[model samples]
Target chain A: MSESRLNVLKTYKLFVGGKFPRSESGRVYEVSDAKGNWLANAPLASRKDARDAVVAARKAFGGWSGATAYNRGQVLYRVAEMLEGRREQFVREVADAEGLSKSKAAAVVDSGIDRWVWYAGWTDKIGQIAGAANPVAGPYFNLSTTEPTGVVTVLAPQDSSFLGLISVLAPVIATGNTAVVVTSYEAPLPALSLAEVLATSDVPGGVVNVLSGKASEIAPHLAAHADVNAIDLTGADADLARELEVAAAENLKRVLRPAVTAEDWTAEPGTERLLAFLETKTVWHPIGV
Target chain B: MPQSIPQTVPAHGPDAAARLASMADVTASDAALRRFLHGLPGVDAVGLEGRAAMLGTRSIKTTAKAYAIDLAISMIDLTTLEGADTPGKVRALCAKGVSPDPTDRTTPRVAAICVYPDMVETAKAALAGSGVHVASVATAFPAGRAALPVKLADTADAVAAGADEIDMVIDRGAFLAGRYLSVFEEIKAVKQACAREDGSAAHLKVIFENGELSTYDNIRRASWLAMLAGADFIKTSTGKVAVNATPPGTLLMLEAVRDFRAATGVQVGVKPAGGIRTSKDAIKYLVMVNETLGEEWLTPEWFRFGASSLLNDLLMQRQKLSTGRYSGPDYVTVD
Candidate 1:
């Protein structure tokens, strides 16, 4: 009876604008496990795919950014809930992707879910912490509030596929900005799987677009894209990051430089990533007007 | 210019006029118009759509894409027909029409600026000396529910206001009710209304509002009917309707112009207005035109995109081509 059964395989596709699509270039690269066993073929997105993702992210920007902070918080929490239900699948994928043992993979998956929940809580609170009623030296009530900085292009961390990817992605969107995330090159399976979670979660389509491909190939286009408002270079290496920073300057895009040291995925996170994609808009109202 | 002279006769050699006049028997009466319109070859919906979709798949890239983008830019009838349109808005739209991308001087200007009858003077004044024509929609515009006299007065008012082109809407209710001669007579009447005192008439673009016509067969019949009634251009829709322009609908119109030219040698223009927003879609239409009507109809004179937002997408794509980076809306004007 066991001999007659065949194992079902999954097709990994790029998630752009809330739908799963193969690369417009129709190219896919082979992905393997830690021991070099072939796992699946992930779409090797082209510059065109990166462009399409920017368009999708821009289209989703108005609705997603206009959503109530409380509603956004609920959506992020819903992503965590979806991840909790798919814990076993993530554990398996993370185990295969990072060459970790099942127990360690399960722990990492749990951490990723916790990360989503953590950011979900920050959605409504980040503004209160970051914004203020400015004290001006005049008879005026000046208010400063934070706004989402439009479409953001995110490069997911390479080594820590599941936890690190979620760490960078959750905050960009949780704060209201839409994202075009380029998943880690070698271990894209976990990120592609996470896209399914985001889709099923209440996250609106285009709010977080996921493309699985070489970061070096896709990041440059996105970094230089005039439409992309900001870019997180966390997944890029030294040389690529330098080039991308220069490209991002053409349109004066907000650039999040990669850390000099290897990031500790398990460490308690800070509010830096959440603040990276937000802008402060100051309004001054005359006292008696 | 007399009403007795059928407007179907092109303003050209006597040979061309004689040829078109000979074919005028088709519109001699209601029965003749009905038989002629019905007698045209029936559209193979599957085959037409298949060909259009097949042509749409042609990959235009790099230098070719650059050329197509520029060509498409020149073909746009930058339109603003909102009820709340102000003089300021029309002037801004006129400035945009003159220099689509103010940042890039090389960007070709659009063919015309389309507006309503009341705003014709503002648009004409704003577009003066820019080489961009002011096109005013007449004949009660999007609905076309008014009487023939009111429609003609509307057309005459726009013409007096210095409009270079008059985009008139056909009586769709009459057409749908199989009153082909009435629609044909109305179009002929509007064509006469387009005449100016200087012996020059504004080019007449007849809108079918193909969405309301209900069938591909009707669209084909409408296309022929407009072309035969002396429409300088046959436009797809008014852009107010829910379904303005679709690929297959545009393809059918293109085929109509192509066949009309072959049959009568009066190469009428085709304008697929509304709902086309991206450079990729614009390039697809260019590819369709190149394949269907050949290179001759590729210019702004023969084909046009009746759009407002399409210009920005074309400009963005042009910037992407020049800089090798994707351009965004922030870089373009908000309009």
Candidate 2:
């Protein structure tokens, strides 16, 4: 049997608890490839899975965030390492997920891995680079640093699943923030495989969580979730992006709109990603010395 | 307690083209219109300056002395210390208290003294309580491409130094990229920062730099945007561009102010600055304002011209109009 046909025959399942398992809800739906070919019977993620994903995300946050910047960098870099080992699996998965050729898929996968390495190094250096000491009139010495904005819930882009997922996750996790990314609706298999790669890599569980389901069902929950400190709707459709932008305003959550460009997303300055995930914290300590 | 707009005709209509034509006729050969009306048995413009009619207050302030009579010095432009060159020339003008003409001392002084931001305190001290105000341009003046916080700080520092009016340039790149809301919000935020040290906002005039926008539609849109975004005034340009204040620009901006007042009842002043080097150019702007916005907006309270050499010509014109004998530089008062 051909590899794609053989792969499609395997019942698609949710990746959680460090393994791929049928959703506790036990419901399945046929998801099609971009060409309308039946790919697999993927799990129709339920609210329970979403709640469970949050649990996983919250549980993983402390250790992932508290780890030294160097350790987190090491973890992210390891994700690159594992993906390199399973390159063929990803090439087929990305091709089916985004309706691209195997060569194109391989190129995207390579770019995704490189993006992680680039962001991994940023975890340790972002603070010292963008912040400074303010010259206030009072006696307090004012110093500023950029901190990770906390749990960033991302709605990955509609197209370019693997690269979009990696681009969105890298910057968020690089700053010590945990993320729960909603997988592409029509083609989520590659996202599941990405989660598998992250699981085995040095990345601790919950630092990056992937959930596959209807974006309409998942976005409102993430946007309205008080536990999620920031949200990136770069993957959201027009209606969803607007709705998320409005919902995010309730708590004054820092929201980053989906990157809209026809050019190479990598060619743009990294500030668009870095600034979106960073929080400026100005500290004041009375100077008596 | 703001009242609804106090004018007839909807803000827009099917025949906007025709209405503009009628207004053109109403202002054309102004003398004939005035004459035909005065010839009426009961109608007259004579001795009718009462009724808040400040349009007659519209006059050009220039430096040239002696020409035709009735032409007045509406302002005395203080270009800069460099333009003034020697302190002797500046002290002479200051000592003269901005005399209207060498032949007479009865005419009032020009509206205000405009200069570089660094010289604001000096001008404020020099012109303090002398019925002349001090204005400064902020937000990096020409480009206005600074960070939001830094831009706000620059405005605050300028206002704290006694700049009664602040002229700022909007983020032109944002406007060009169709980021209207961002540009509007940025102007609003900067204007909010212009308040007194106690957090009370200062008077803000957003410079559209119409020369940069280069189109009537864009100028009109920018004017309305600035007005709606809480700008106290909408200025034409930064006075640095080649084609600063064209007749069409002033006309379009006046219509914007007119439409805004007809809708919101808030009267926003207009300043057609930049490249206004002659009294004639200055007077054309006044005429545009008088016709488009009507007479109520003609006072210095709602109108101004940012000119360096226009004031010299206006003064010389007023002297010639009064004395009928124009002379060299010695005939005019420096201060």
Candidate 3:
């Protein structure tokens, strides 16, 4: 006969530059479950946190974008493998966050893992689908290639914590762009847990920085940051999205406007998100005799 | 502290000659020089490092940050010391020093432009009448392994080419081997070479290469020795080594200069040359200078940052302040 012991709670922190650090401002807000039970204290990231995430993402853009597409695909596939191993923890987190039954949460978690694998397969093939050779009327070879548009700031959907988050985040990194993700403000636990899986799955540090805070608080800074090359406003409300879009115009950043309706996370995701953060570069070579 | 020493001994005068003669009495003998340097109070490594780390945590923001950025911009010794350096590069660096941010006309000019001895003439020519002094690194530079005569010739060449400042390196081997008088004598000889026909000498900045010294005590000793030998400024590193211009090392040197001024009315400048890149780091150093030596040493005449990349960072930060948005490397000119 043994006595019951107290449970050791995990301290959740923001993942930046592939390391877990507390918010630089030392602010945290309470995140509750769908039933209004306090789950944990998530870092209330400030503009400084967003600034630091942009720096990290910019620093990582060179190496991750320079790697062979096949290598990136392998790394993304490895993330899927790591996600498979942590399926139970994510299932529990999703169940509490989305107010679903264990079976339903497990189904969502499985779909998220499959979504990662689907993007992993797309990493190598995205270049061929997006780039081409030009038929110029000259004695020269003109070819167009795709390049990762430096650093991207991603706003993970507010309501769908796991599956929807993966559907938006995987395509950004799969195409070689490093991402600074602002996780779901109400339910950041699943996204933060996914950061752990990304860390162990052979993805390089700074490649995917996850900040758990309000999109409204952090998005405006990232949108206006000169170092950030693009912005995806999937998590922002209409007013916030419009404000971010206006701010993003300062740098002429590529902006992916938020969908008009709630996106279906379980449906097939097209190449729209994959091609959003890529820049096409064309080069000309003389045809020597 | 030792007895109050005399102020700077000018060249070619009866009173100045007497002052110079008296100054030589401190380094009159090798044993006396060693005794005087070792007699200075030993530095407490842990306490010094603790104070430096504490000073580094001060949060400077808004108006204070803006003022500090401008002050820091004016104190930079815009340097480009490489074997691959060209006249074109030196001219460009001088132009950049004249106006750090071409977009913002309000941005302050740097204190000087530092280049290799060969590029001094080009830099001086480009910076003619710009009010930004041209500084040349001489005395065999990062490695002061050459003979004393060769070192003096190097200093003389730069001074003859119209360099306003001569940044010379001390023989770290001699300093490490306990040959204090030889190193002191070498510095004095270089100071002699800095003299011009009109009795105005190019300001002599002595490099101690604190990374190779390996202890704070040695850095303190080196600071006193260089000041005693008439160094217009004492620099921390050549920026060639692995560890250059750390907070503790810079703080210790600043303390030495503050005490040196108290002991003797003669004030020497302090320059931490290497690895200080970001504006935040530049501000931390400014905070250290303001706290350690007060506002008097906060000017460009007493302190300088020997950097190349630091200018762009400061410019970027300057833009960030005015525009209310962060700036990037793409916004600043390529060095």
- Winning candidate number (DockQ): 1
Per-prediction TM-score, chain B alone: 0.95, 0.74, 0.94
Check candidate 1 and list the clashing pairs.
Answer: none
List clashing residue pairs in candidate 3: none
DockQ scores of all models, one per candidate: 0.94, 0.00, 0.78
Instruction: Please report, as a value between 0 and 1, the fraction of native contacts recovered by candidate 1.
Output: 1.00
The DockQ ranking, best first, is: 1, 3, 2
In candidate 1, residue A54 scores what lDDT? 88
lDDT of 3 by residue, A47-84 (tens): 88888888888888899999999999999999999999
lDDT of 2: 0.70
Q: Which of candidates 2 and 3 is the stronger one according to TM-score?
A: 3
Error of 3 at A10 (Å): 0.5
Off by over 4 Å in 2: A1-9, A17-21, A137-141, A260-266, B1-335
For model 1, how does the per-residue alpha-carbon lDDT over B158-211 read when each residue is reduced to its tens digit? Answer: 999999999999999999999999999999899889889988789999999989
Report the lDDT tens digits of candidate 2 across residue range B1-335. Answer: 32562343222222332333443432245354334323323312231222114433455433322221222245333444244444444445444445555467755566666655666676677776777777777887778888989888888788888887788899888877666667777886887777786655557889998888855556766776677566777888887767787666676677778876665556678877777766566666666666778777767767777766666656655554554333223345443
lDDT of 3 at A133: 88
DockQ result, candidate 1: 0.94
